[model samples]
Target: MESQAAFNYQQQVEEIRLAMGCDFVALALVQSEERHFQIRWEFASGNLSQRFRRIVLHSGKGVAGIVFKTGKPIFVPDAHQYYKKEDMYNYPILIAEELESFAAIPLFKYNRVKGILLAGCRKQKCMSIEKFELLQSLVTPTFGPYYSEEVTGI
Candidate 1:
């Protein structure tokens, strides 16, 4: 896609966050050839800190990285209960974004994970499976070059 058109990434993420009433929404994208596939949060909404923007994740380090490596979706409700605080920092996006419950879905292009779209809530257990499913449905089959694997029959 043209870089100009792609600049709408932040706008689209914010729209999704508002529509879902999520506390935070962010998009993580793999850097082009210059960065050798390193991933970073490219856009965010309702962010608590800028720490996430400085983080450059490898292919399997954190949630977005893991999703990119495995080409799968990840959901964590009640992050404090699901992950210890010490370990939680590994996911800088979660920490800087102040996400308590979150889901990360891979955005695919040509059957490869190109980026991740994340939605989160600051309140524990605020993101239900139904909402997660809905979010998945909403982005599937569309969303720039990213398509949900489940809907793509992959």
Candidate 2:
């Protein structure tokens, strides 16, 4: 069974998706230390399918991986313009969600990146700079069990 914390994360992701009017929003978290800290999407809203559950990522790999590895955010205002045809396969989430634009932010804990929160739009130009800034403002300092920025302690 899923824990309450996990359920709450889903609710939060949904809220963010609704607020941003985005096509998709998801949260990827690190697995236990025994699992070598692998990352997987644990919560999602407006998902196209269950494929995301099957995908596991390591640091510096996918969108979540990049944000988690660098503890910084990434904004792809235009997926078609940003990624080449050959490299499109590298971002499975984008393809899965049919996203034309997207952004990801690092979720920090104990001054380290422990999760990633991603927001995406299915239509090009739907994810504007103002929307990205709104996303950043919404999650700053802390959001649920994670921090938008790397900070010491809670």
Candidate 3:
């Protein structure tokens, strides 16, 4: 049943990618058993390679890990401008997946981060703030277990 659920989750992610017309989309989920706070890219769409499937991310390590820890969305229009090449290795999924621009959004279940959803392009500056906002709008009210925590603006 667990495996089936994971499979279903992957399918949903693919559906989201197609619906959004995104260049690429991937999801990284934490294991339910909590044996370790390890994260892995469980699903991908529009992939150039399958290398990301094997990479495991620790908390506060990469894009997903940072979003997972902070419970905030991360939008990078140009990875080269925002992150150094030396720091790229920390986000093995990005390097392995060959992503140059991306956004990482936290998925919440019961007010806690349960996973991360990453949408990206292989070219620099391919994503924009408008697209990011639209993506956020699209994912907020629905998209399964992922929910943004309510924030009260000052």
Highest TM-score against the true fold, candidate? 2
Estimate, for each residue in 33-116, the C-alpha lDDT of model 3 and write its tens digit.
555888888888888888888888778988888998888999999899988888888878778778888888887776778888
Tens-place lDDT digits, model 1, residues 1-154: 4444454677778888888889998888888767888999988888887777898998998988899999989888889988888898788887777788999899877777889988999889988898789779867533765678734554
- Candidate 1, residue 14: the lDDT equals 84
Between 1 and 3, whose lDDT is larger? 1
- lDDT, candidate 3, residue 9? 61
Pick the winner on TM-score between candidates 1 and 2: 2
Per-residue alpha-carbon lDDT of candidate 2 for residues 1-154, written as tens digits (9 for 90 to 100) = 2245443677788888999999999999988779987999988999999888888988888898888778899999999898998998888888888989999988776688888889999998899898888888777533655667767555
- Candidate 1 matches the true fold with a TM-score of 0.88
Q: Give one clash count per candidate, in the order shown.
A: 0, 0, 0
True-structure RMSD for candidate 1: 2.5
Error of 3 at 16 (Å): 2.3
Q: In terms of TM-score, which candidate is stronger, 1 or 3?
A: 1
- Lowest-scoring 10 consecutive residues by lDDT in candidate 2? 1-10
Enumerate residue pairs that collide in model 1: none
